[model samples]
Target: MNPFNKSTGRVVLGGAGWSRQIVTDPTSKPVLQTILHALSLGIRAFDTSPYYDPSEILLGAAFSDPALTSKYPRSDLLLLTKCGRITANDFDYSPAAIRASVRRSLDRFSTTYLDVVFTHDVEFVSREEALGAVKTLFEMRDEGYIKHVGISGYPPAVLADIAVEIRQKLGKPVDVVQTYCHMNIQNTTLQRSLGRFYGDAGVGIVLNASPICMGLLRKGGVPIGELGDFHPAPRGLREAAAKAADWVEGQGENMASLALRYAVGTFASVDEKGLGVTILGGGSIEEITENVETVKKMLKMEDNSVEALDLRDYSLFDEEAYKKDEPLFKGVRDILGEWIDYTWDSPDAAFLEEREKRKNQEK
Candidate 1:
């Protein structure tokens, strides 16, 4: 199997987060071209959910483009969709609803089957409800309408717990798990916990929170709350973000460079031999182009280290506390003072609670 397949490379590109940009475009030529360009690059994994506005419709449009399918058959690419959260509805994990959603995805994409189908509400659903839905998805897979079965949610603990259940109850490990483990506006301690946890779980994990952290980390004290959930540069995130921005500015490198490097740094440790696809969403062509270049640069960097840098050299860093002054953000003390101060209790921690659990379980 290709490492980049649903099993190995671990990178899953997100589609719905581009709802405002991709879905809103009816006559847009550039966006459609960019999507094709990405497909041409061997980055085949795509992710979408109904909650992302009209992502399903927009993606269908891109896939249905005559120029694209003519060159690359739909079978060449692997597609995954999450169910449970709908635009005007709450999270629903009922077996009937799950089956209907998969059918809708198959019908919308004009594909005969799904490459992978996730419950999307894995974290919120109880053991029994999840098992019930999982049963139906497996049946679909057995029937050849769905090729793989996966789950995704905001929280990793729930993700792990359910993943364990699937393995034990059905004797088959899940094919993929999606969660937010981005570079910027993220909790490092929590990320470490989850990465280590999932690594140990040996289940294929596709990270969705990559560019999200980059967008925030590239900033020098930018606002936090208003950014997209796909781009949440949280309130306190501005504080740490400012320091990183300053450092990049001082290095004479572009913000995009530092952001891309940091986004993939930790989860993609060279030592661990890890890899995953990340969604690089953009509101415009230039933004997408710039991001693509950044990803290229990050790949070309001399340092193969995927772990985040230790800020001890910059004076703003307190390695013991993982806290640094504004200079730590940039490697600028004064600049760090102006950032939005973030707390550990933020919801992001809950996002990676499974990492924490895995650590405890090991102990």
Candidate 2:
């Protein structure tokens, strides 16, 4: 069966927003409101990870609420979740561990089957471990536990390589892939590497998250508390982003909204036929409203005077349309020229140090 044949919507409601008190707090009205509102906005997919605290349970409860059950039942939504890389310092790719993780996720989400299950953040682990996780997920797929199986990671090159490796070892293509921060305005690695993932590696659908690149592209900057000390990007990139945000505001547009528009707009407008989904995290009802509005504008622009070109407009394989329409953003790209496509290390040095400590203890 074609993996993309199902009703996987173009936009997915991200569960990262519910990671902390939003999900942990049982009476969080905002969480329920956001999910209901998202369903109203035509978002039929939800992406969550076990590592994201109680997100899975929170989403499950929200979907099963009596007020929403009949109007938007579990059957109405496409459930997507991930396993492996449990925390910054914890990662388990063993077959038995992965199998157990999936079962626990099923319980947490209160679902019989998952629409998709991804091996989260495969770059930090060894190839053998990563492939083992994918193999087990594929096994789960065959067992009728998951409809589609795939992997997600930060590095496009690493994700592409692993997708190809999985196809070679398992004799089937990866059904989906989730990569964040790569398709945003500052970094377009996902766009540049689309051909490799779609053609060479055989990824059926691609999901892009963090249109604002984890708040680095927010006005001022990402608060140190929100992302902690290991926030990845260099100080220079952060500073440049702040300046760009101010520059964008001077042009009378919200920086975060503009970034969202560019990322969501380009992907939704492009008629490539290859399925793509943008995962957006919403904290409150207003945030969900803003996201839905951004998507509406994205769709409207195609019929309006924007004359936005289709994905075909980009030469043979490139998907970075921001560079092509650099003139529209009023030199924001020029201001960030020094940091374009610049990526800091993921599973940062601190994470790596803890990884070694864990290994030593295990040994």
The CA lDDT of each predicted structure is 0.56, 0.74
Q: Which candidate comes out best when scored by lDDT?
A: 2
Q: What CA root-mean-square deviation does each model show from the true structure?
A: 9.7, 4.9
**What TM-score, computed on C-alpha atoms, does each candidate reach?**
0.71, 0.87
Residue 180, model 1: Cα distance from true site in angstroms: 0.8
Could you tally the backbone clashes for each prediction?
24, 0
In candidate 2 the C-alpha lDDT for residue 257 amounts to 81
Off by over 4 Å in 2: 1-8, 21-29, 223-230, 268-274, 301-326, 357-363
Best by TM-score: 2
Off by over 4 Å in 1: 1-12, 21-30, 87-89, 182-186, 189-202, 220-234, 242-247, 270-273, 300-363
